[model samples]
Target: MTWTIAGSLAVVPAPTRTDLLAEPVAKALAALADPDAVGVAEIDPSLADTAAFCEAYGSPLEASANCVVVAGKRAGEVRFAAALVLATTRADVNGVIKRRLDVRKASFAPMDEAVSLTGMEYGGITPVGLPAEWPILLDRRVAEAPELVIGSGIRGSKLLISGAALAALPGAEVIEDLAR
Candidate 1:
């Protein structure tokens, strides 16, 4: 099945272990994505954020997934996780995430902290290459999508992959009601 905007974009083979930020994402792609199934497309860095990307590239909002870093603390220990949800909806941070992380509260991670820890730009944190210890909480809706667009751990490019491919990533955990 053709992905949204696949015909109108300049997609190429996804970069494999190229940069610190892309390293894990590349490895995830290699391990989980079918050959040639994961496509990469370059974009203006200024428009790399989700809303602008979909608007500029003619990608449907429903076909775009956002990976957000969330953090919470309990017993003086802080934990971080990446949450993947459809661009049309927001992750259920206060409820589902907090419960899953077993923390009193969960919130979007501070920009500096997220970037520094993930080694990715503030707006380009994807689940593919997250630290092995962090759980990749994927929304059921997103996991059910046939194809979707996601960050590539950098501001200038994005990855196009099927939901099955994403769900199969080593750390991915399908969570029902993960988004609202």
Candidate 2:
């Protein structure tokens, strides 16, 4: 969607814009506002799911944001882990993530745990469907895109949302180089 400001000075289109496809992203948007705002787009039922999805929608693979969930120990005793990284950058498994989670080592959450906990497929565990307490670490670069293609809490399809909107999700924190 486009937000325009019309005043005595001049009319200007907002720097950020978001659209609600009749898919995964729409639902996500609703959740973000009152219910949610993320939506999922049903892509070709092929092995190369995301690639196929991109081809169908004329979206580029590089333009997609990858979100991953990690679980590990935090602090000397307290345990915590769960992060979202962009497809462009690697998760700072040894830096901020390690320091933020306060763990010497961190790894991807087990597939079963990821699926069971988030109710999203292995290739589609978005921050939206993650456990309510899960901390969402978003990369700043992801927001640079006019919009981003992301998961809609599912794998059968992909969803699109404004990067800014995704950042606005409750509990989501913006970090630069959150990944390696």
Candidate 3:
């Protein structure tokens, strides 16, 4: 089947789990997806960020999901989580998430820390192959999208899969009001 994103981006068979450059993305797919249903496409490095990617690729913001790393501290120990929300919304780091984590405060993880911890690039940190210890929080809407586009753990590519495939990832938790 030919998979295209918003009628512009051509999505071909995703790289296999053994593909070194996309190891994390591959690992995630191996663990959570039906290999035949996943698709991937390369994009310009300059369009790696969400807005640029959506606009340049003819994908609507509503069809894109952003994965953000969040950090919180309680009892002198830092805890991390991955929050998935549609590009049209923002994660509720200060309110809902902070309360959910039971931390005094919760904030976006530092860029360097997010990249280092995920072993992914700054603009391509995806919830897919995140550390098993961290919770993968998905906004209700994100969990319901028929299909969506997300990072491939590298700036040069994007992963296209059904929302159900994403929610099935290990440790994914669907929550209402996760984004606003």
Clashes of each: 0, 27, 0
lDDT of 3 by residue, 88-142 (tens): 9999999989988889999999999998899888888888789999999999999
- Better by TM-score, candidate 3 or 1: 3
- 122-159, model 1: which lDDT tens digit per residue? 78889887888999999999899998889988888888
TM-score of each: 0.91, 0.72, 0.93
Worst 10 residues of 3 by lDDT: 13-22
* Residue 135 miss distance in model 3 (angstroms): 0.2
lDDT of 1: 0.83
**Which of 1 and 2 is the better model by TM-score?**
1
lDDT by candidate, in order shown: 0.83, 0.58, 0.84
- Over 97-153, each residue of candidate 2 has an lDDT whose tens digit, in order, gives 766676768777778977776656667656664555667788777755556666655
RMSD to the true structure for each prediction, in A, is 2.2, 8.0, 1.8
Our model 3 lands, by Cα RMSD against the true structure, at 1.8
lDDT, residue 36, model 1: 64
With a 3 Å backbone cut-off (N, CA, C), the pairs that clash in candidate 1 are none
